[model samples]
Target chain A: MNKWTKLDNAAIVFPSLAKAKNSTIYRVSAVLKETVLPVRLQQALDITVKRYPMMTMRIHKGLFWRYMEYDDEPLRVKREDDYPCHPLQDRMTMEALLKVFYYQRRISVEVFHAITDGSGAMEFLKTLVYEYLRLLGKAVEPEDKIRTASEDIHPEELEDSFHRYYTPGRPPKIRNTKAYQITGTYFEPYGNNVTQGVVSASALRQIAKKQGATLTEFLLALLMYTIYRQSSQDRKDQRPIKVSVPVNLRQMFPSKTLRNFFAVALFEISSQQEQSLFKILCAIKEQSVKNYSKKVLQEAIVRNINLEKIKIARFIPLPIKDIIVKNRYFLYNDKLRTCTMTNLGRVDLPKTMTPYVDRMEVVFYPTANNPLNCGLCTVNDNMTISFSRTIRENRIIGEYFRYLSQEYGLEVKIYSNEWGISD
Target chain B: MNGGFQINHCIHCQVTVEASLQECPLCGKKLTNTRLSVPRSYPAYALHNKSSYYFQLFWKTLVPLMFIGAFLIPSLITLLTGEGDLWLNRETLGIASAWVLVRYTFLSRMHMGKKFLLQIMNISLALFIFDHVGEARGWSVNYVIPFMLICSTLAMMYIVYKRKRLWSDYAVYVMTLIFLGFLPSFLYLIRVTSLLWPSAAAAGFAIVSLIAVYFFLDKNFRSYFNRRLHF
Candidate 1:
């Protein structure tokens, strides 16, 4: 017998929408100062999985929807061989929804979206790395920052905060328009190619503060402007380049559940008339301020929870509901957004564990509709802006990094997984 | 790690990116500067192993093509000869259904007990259809259907007894199979099935099983089905 849990309000859409081409798996990795030892990593994973019992389960299809069943067995940590964020194949079986992989000096944790969000994944990664370092006899302390193996699992960690925060019968009317989509050739051998540009987080923050914009807003404006400049001369091409920004709700609510408790805020802008990047920044700033409010964020939570509460939706069989969700998911989503950019603002590890960790990277999985996505994660002073894409043309990615380096004079270092690069 | 001392700066983009590449990946410009070699942050995934993905894609594509061709070739021959109105004659339908049954059995990741029950039901349906159109022979309802229902019920009981841990999950399916066994007796009462012995056996076994389960496992199944069929 296993303890079962339901998928959160924001998580129910992922399992149906996932396909071979569009695997809804995101990764959070940390490069260590030393090479990864597989045996020690496996031991560390066993201990860490026990610590975060909420993430220690496999996804199973239930009568009405999907649920997670506790797997008493330990999850195996494999050596990294596949492309980053490839689909987890043991979905319907007894394997853990989260996988731990090691390649040389990097340790990556890839998770199916149905289990948890980025914040949850990050906490698991931090704990796993801490245990791995401590196992190797490094002088690392939890400093009460990392969840150690001895701590008891909190009931609040497994709580679905969305259901707690949502108010019944308060559905807000949302207006959505089709946005300008980025078009490019689908790269052969279908994989996620990650290209990361690392720069100083403080220096970039100083520039954003001078421009009267937050770092996320400034980056969104920069991305929108890049696409606008590259748009064709036709009038139809001047559509709003909408970037979906996922707002972590732990900041607003006092709940500390490690499940999905985030709401997406769509940052949209376009240039019907000729507009400068400054104007784009101003537009993004205005929208961000409004959209970042607690009232609007509450509306987002209410809107999502209301969809799951439809009278008819509860009675449909899981198989038929899977078909309906697969066909209708993109119609209501991804069409309204050009791409997504999720910023996991600065990750602070305990000072005792800082020297062994090099830097961290957040990899957002790209979908079929939105072929490119950006993930920002700052550790120590380094902010890595990783572009995970499935298409061949990288003009938007190329220009964004160049603009950051040239305009701001930030010494940006770069690396890639090189999935489809010719040379 | 900032271990790169060689600045492979692309003058075309006027920005430095990779420290080891011979050319900039963005502009494809020649930025070959070699001084200190640094280990890469990510493994070079340029060497892609296309076997697993392409193999799955191959079967998914080829199975549908084979199914289409199987239907089309016979239809084309019949249209050219003008010998048939329905392109899928009895034999062709049987062959196609057999192929589909085999494919479903191999491909479905469903629970085993449910899959077994569904497979037997499908086979019984094909037998029923075969009797209806072929000779109007009463063999399907008279013998084959009732016997299959009886045997499937016994098999379901054996499975439930063997896997008692998953008995709750299998409880609904096993009970459904037992209830389906009573259908043959109904057909006999309606005079659609004239042979009384096969129908009596199936219905008798179903009644005995029902009595035993009600006496022995009533409390168990009552609670299980209550939550499952609540909606």
Candidate 2:
């Protein structure tokens, strides 16, 4: 019999909210120095799935909740044909939450948010690349951090970190004040227009250093400014443009579990007062510093856990809970944030394998209501800023890079899938 | 330059190659070096195919038209013929309700269990409305609802028993079904209808099933309750 495990607290909300438009899926890709070999890639994937058993599991419905169970079905790799971060309909495929796709020199792993977060996905991607290289008879080292397929699966990798780190206390309640919302005509055929801008990490770092802010803070400030400029300026009452930044909790708490272990912190820039780039960067720096602090993050963890711990919540049937949670997430999380900016930070690979890989990109799926989202990751001093938008208008994206080129004097190389939606 | 050809370097992989190729020969990544002021890897323009949008548009336009046609044709016949009998209008309403139920069952994106519950609720409501409109018969209350409650309870019990690994998961659903099965008996006790046999049978079946699960399958029952009721 296959082993079954209950979903962690953070994963409880994704299954209920996933739909065609809002899949809650994300992609992490590694571009190699050579074309991807399908046979070798599949062989590597078969081995990698055994190491990350949780990623290969299928979601099973329960009375009051949903759980994950091991699936004996084989994990297969296919060529990239569809758009990135498409919905994973269990009935239509092998029932795995994670899928491996390859195209030309790029190998991508797309995962439904219910299984794991970006940190977990990155680990899996690195291991897969390592194994693939090894299979091709290339000299690759494990580097101690990369969990290889040959090693036995550790109990720590499967631990539910939320339950492990949860402390008994009254979590602080957050007010549900409405934030600014971006509205636009969605692209036809329910597709996401992916536009990636590549730039030198050193250049961005230099600018950020001059401004006395980190790269993430600098990017968040730029995003807020872009949204502010895009919105109607005639209105007297303008809500603050809030960006939801997902913070990986592994940095704060000591846990090696490859599950959904992350929390979101909202960074708001008020439109009521006209602000310069420096002022916006300061706002982002202040909010991020306070929110990502140990005490504040602990409270956020407690708040999320306490929600599931309520006696009444446990008794409520899954169907009813699904509707309630889905609506609540739509009203609170989606409406309260103008857009989400998730930075995977710098990606480190094995020294031996670094020469074989080119660059990496992360793409987040757009929600049904919210059309635009941003994902950033840096590899080998190359920063890739990827924008996945479902809207027809590309003005915000155009203005964002424009500001970078004009103000910061950084030349950006742009590539796009060209989704062909016009304003 | 060899044969009047220039060379470009891939900034990412550090591989140098010919400039004629759009991407590097070693890595499939697009070349960074270009003669143009601004370099772009892919094409600058794309074609918009709105077929999928039009497909959704077609369905959106068709459903209302079908609904109007369903109501309009029958009412028009009655109006033109000047018939005194309004039974045809009542029959049309029944058909419309049934159609609506069928559409809901097919169109809804709910889970199987939720869909089953919705089916039970919709069927019961439709039968009750039919009973009141046509001769005020008590078949819907005394037989159909009780029968549906019993079948649903039994189906749920079988599913819970078969999926042993998920028995604890379905404990609450099975318990709720058991309680719902007895509601028909409560209606009978209040003297709302002349019939009592269906209610008695459903309630007895529910009670016996619960007893069987707790007594004969004691071990499974205990484990399920332990996991489900764990604080």
Candidate 3:
């Protein structure tokens, strides 16, 4: 509550790179069985903001760096308007870096990346929905998964976990990475087109088990294969379809901070067209296992902290640092990834809350360079795979959904925000 | 598919579309079954209406139009008309004034109090520049800036009073405007201006506004300074 705090290590990179075209905003939503009541939702949000005071902080530029300060204005719960992942700028960031919106049956929380990562945002969404359900007179308990309003705020929740766990001078376990970037005609009004596919979580897990892999490894291979199938025969082996997967570090190292504490693990599949998806899944599992050694994560934490700790980098004015970051982003940020996919794995709610909730979705905003990004989460028995893109052509999406249906015989129920299509 | 939900089967895409959508979001193929439908998972959003479409077009052309409309068109007309007064002409001043005001007022996303102070300063600057170089080179500071400062202070005081909860956040800006209101007095005392009454009125108004705020909202101003220092 004392005025301001520094941006987390991973969060430092996003503010400099964010713009209208390359928004670093990501969304996590829950669709309840009943229609959303705005009044009750607003009340829930007001309570939630008090419980999580960090959500009310706004980022401001200092002479040396950007930092977050407590913004005391009351938070407004907006009725859903505009397309998803429109840039959060100026007034939006000035008010608060996080926003909560509601549609027909959907209550969504869109977060600026400078504030929190996917895991942290998911925690906020779950707590918000829990409070909403309670306000509606439901008998839902926190059940240890949700952050309850009655519980005392712990100091550990505010610690910058990345800085806490960074190990200095550890050499990175690196690899030669070059990925194929998806390109298509840009949408006239720049916005994210979200296409989500809902399937049975148990069925997805069973199928992954049949292929001798975890759900993430299985989906990572399938995504690569889908993109590979769409390419011409001449371009099939031209480049590896690499997916940048974010792994939550709380599982490995013990930390309860609701901030960015995750690392990226790159999984690739190349020249595996002749093999079945099962073989590709096995190969991806192997590659992913090798890439995710603790050394790799330690190096990521160290490197990120080191970049900001450079003596000269700190003294240089923030505007000049932003220019340097922007120039570097245009040259290299998305040059090595086909797309980004962050899976929340499994979302568990209190037993009493399950009947009211239908599904949960995590939709990441696609950057201009990396035109396609995927996010998915499983709650109860339903798994939703959401692909958000900034392009006109959605052939990859159609093919991915179709492939999941025809190959695994997984019943795919598809829906979208329909940003671009006229009809 | 298991919930007896009215769903669309897209044969081409080979996926079952939710009942909310009339066509496949991926393939654009119409729903195979056209019948009475259940509630959709999402609202049927008007993706782009006429106003929004025009706005999109305007947004796309805004940058190029800012350069051409603000700079090129007026300069071109002046060149063709043989009125080559690039910096000091009436037409040029009018266009520049419009451009600065429009950009700062309409486009800036700063906090409302900050933006208001900046806009008033911008207008005062333009007026000062115009007055100093013109045949009449004294009115801006002597009358215009002092009056503008007094008005700005009153406006900010009103905002602070109306939005009591926001007083803590906006009080600093009001204080800033009060500090700026002394500039004309400084100018007059330094003999940069001949008239002292206008400067005196402006500073007198500013001090009176501050006294009123302090006298009435003593606790509020105290807490304002308490929260003023940032970590």
**Reference-based lDDT, each prediction:** 0.80, 0.78, 0.80
Q: What is the interface RMSD of each candidate, in Å?
A: 3.5, 10.0, 3.7
Error of 2 at A49 (Å): 1.1
Candidate 3 at B116: error in angstroms? Answer: 2.6
| TM-score of the second chain in candidate 2 | 0.58
Query: Which is the winner by lDDT between candidate 1 and candidate 3?
Result: 1
Tens-digit per-residue lDDT, B1-231, candidate 1:
362223457676666666766556566566667333665566655353555456556656787678668776777788689887663766666876676576657765556666777788788878888888677778999999999988888888887777654566577678888899889999999998989999999999999888877776777666554544443
Indicate whether candidate 2 or candidate 3 has the larger lDDT: 3
Q: Which candidate is the best by lDDT?
A: 1
Query: DockQ of all candidates, in order?
Result: 0.33, 0.12, 0.33
Worst 10 residues of 1 chain A by lDDT: A87-96
B163-192: candidate 2 lDDT, tens digit per residue = 665554456567777777888889888876
Worst 10 residues of 3 chain B by lDDT: B222-231
Q: Identify the CAPRI category of the predicted complex in candidate 3.
A: acceptable
lDDT of 2 by residue, A240-346 (tens): 88888999999999899999999999898877777878888988888877989999999988998989989998888888999998888886768888889999999
TM-score per candidate, in order?
0.87, 0.77, 0.85
lDDT of model 3 at residue A239?
70
- Order of models, best lDDT first: 1, 3, 2
